[model samples]
Target: MLIKGYDDGPLVAGEPLMTRPGFWSNHLMGMCDDGAGHPVPEWFGDDGADADALSEVLFDPGHWPVFRVPAAEGPGVVVVYRNQPGDYGIDYLLTPPGRSSTEQLTDWEGDLAENGLTWHELVRIADTPVHEAEGAADPAARLLLVLPLLNDLDLPAAAPARLGAALAAAGSPQDTVTHTAESLLAHLMGRSRHDADWASPLSGGY
Candidate 1:
């Protein structure tokens, strides 16, 4: 929804976006030909960005610097950083994409806390030296570090043991059978019988 101007349509997220308008306002940015501009903030280094996917790219200098990534079902909104303050690791906020009213997901947003990491912090923590990475104690940070090992990470003979050790440290060690990813994420956030219907089937909901 990074429209070229106010005439494009409505907002990608919503109104009153941008806490630090300093960057989003004055910069000519976007993933297009920059609307045929000479230079835009989307420009990176000498060559350019790896615009591998257009739908995933955000930032538009002509309008709001962000575009909405829609939810899979129902009417949904992603509360982006531009729409609010603080540097939480949260890329955005959204409900479970169910029948719940938007208010139920967005209500009392002021009551939410701001003490979370940013993308930069997450990358740093994930890349930090094993001994020095204090954020390793944090489940989110630890998860970030170990997740790649669980996926396509190419490891040789000793890597199995290393991966095992890393998984154990992340509290996601191999189970007698395979551990269901859905269960891990859902259980991390805890469960409520009332929320059974909203639960992930992979996690068995309730």
Candidate 2:
């Protein structure tokens, strides 16, 4: 099936995209750090061979291209994903469609499940690369699939040319990173102050 996309203009061919600097390591680290100790993604492996196959997928965009796909219910985005070596298993994180901002899903577990979304085994495709590796699906950062589409769910070879376009588009992934970083930092800072007050003698517990 032909995959539909947002931009109707001719697509210019391009190579795989690399994740922006300071995202995976510094930015992601800062965001995921909380007293609860959430585990961040493994950005890299040992310096030699025998690296984890999906170790760098999300951190290194070249291995994991962010794209849009039809959700079971409506339009959704398949941002960062990792499939096994045989491509047998696919695990991904998506922002539920029809939301104004990803902030609506901040309560991830309760929110996603309430929306009937799961992080694993969503797509049922025969050939893994044919569907996903075809090209950048939502490079223009538009909601709908722009490339030609025979049907909605089954997207085919799309325009890789549009990949870099989202960087300049409003509400792009970069924007998500920026907003999330701000919120996370604020949360951590507030928590630190709260804890400090509890420990302080002036708190009047004594």
Candidate 3:
């Protein structure tokens, strides 16, 4: 599952907010500020800043690379792609200035069409209630539950379940449960995937 949005303003009613340029930039970058006056990174390939020059590289119908950078001033861009044989595809997200959060999310969804990438929006789990089960007491079990949920939310399958387990195992065992929850949250937000070295926080086991 993949989840992407920008940190701008709140989506307004009756106004199409997804067309903003900042939303495009933030959506491509995968991370945006929470509308709290934070910085956004620049486009990866706009000026040959280490991004491939081929527009086809973004929609080749295969597995591709993901890119991310620290929260900085100016513009920010992030992209995630799959590198399957004979098929390469990429997703673009960016954080432009003066937009709402919902607008940013909507733009990320819209960019799929603009960039010719195939994808589906994740279903909202706000109705899924957290129950008190034995697994809730075991971090590993909790992590497992959360992982699948994030997967349901469109996070990549390569997310680190083992890391969630380890984080669950390290502390008071109960603390692991929280870690698992956090892991699920991170995954939903495209933060911790094993194959996502370019953007995965788990790249260094953190």
Winner by TM-score? 2
Among all candidates shown, the one with the greatest lDDT: 3
Could you tell me every candidate's TM-score relative to the true structure? 0.21, 0.22, 0.18
CA lDDT of each prediction against the hidden true structure: 0.28, 0.27, 0.29
Of 2 and 3, the candidate ranking higher by lDDT? 3
lDDT of 2 by residue, 1-206 (tens): 11123122222222233233322232223333344655333321112121223234333433433343433343343333222243322222333345422211111211111122211112211112223433333333222121111112222232111222322332235423433333333333333122221221111211
- TM-score between model 3 and native: 0.18
Which candidate, 1 or 2, would have the higher TM-score against the true structure?
Answer: 2
Compose the digit string of candidate 1's lDDT tens values, residues 1-206.
43222344334542223222222212112211222334322222112322322212233332233323232322222333232224222132322334332221221122223222222222333343334311123333233322211211122344334333433443332551022232222222221122223321112211
The model with the greater lDDT, 1 or 3, is: 3
lDDT of 2: 0.27
**Clashes per candidate (backbone, < 3 Å):** 2, 8, 45
Evaluated against the true structure, the overall lDDT of model 3 is 0.29
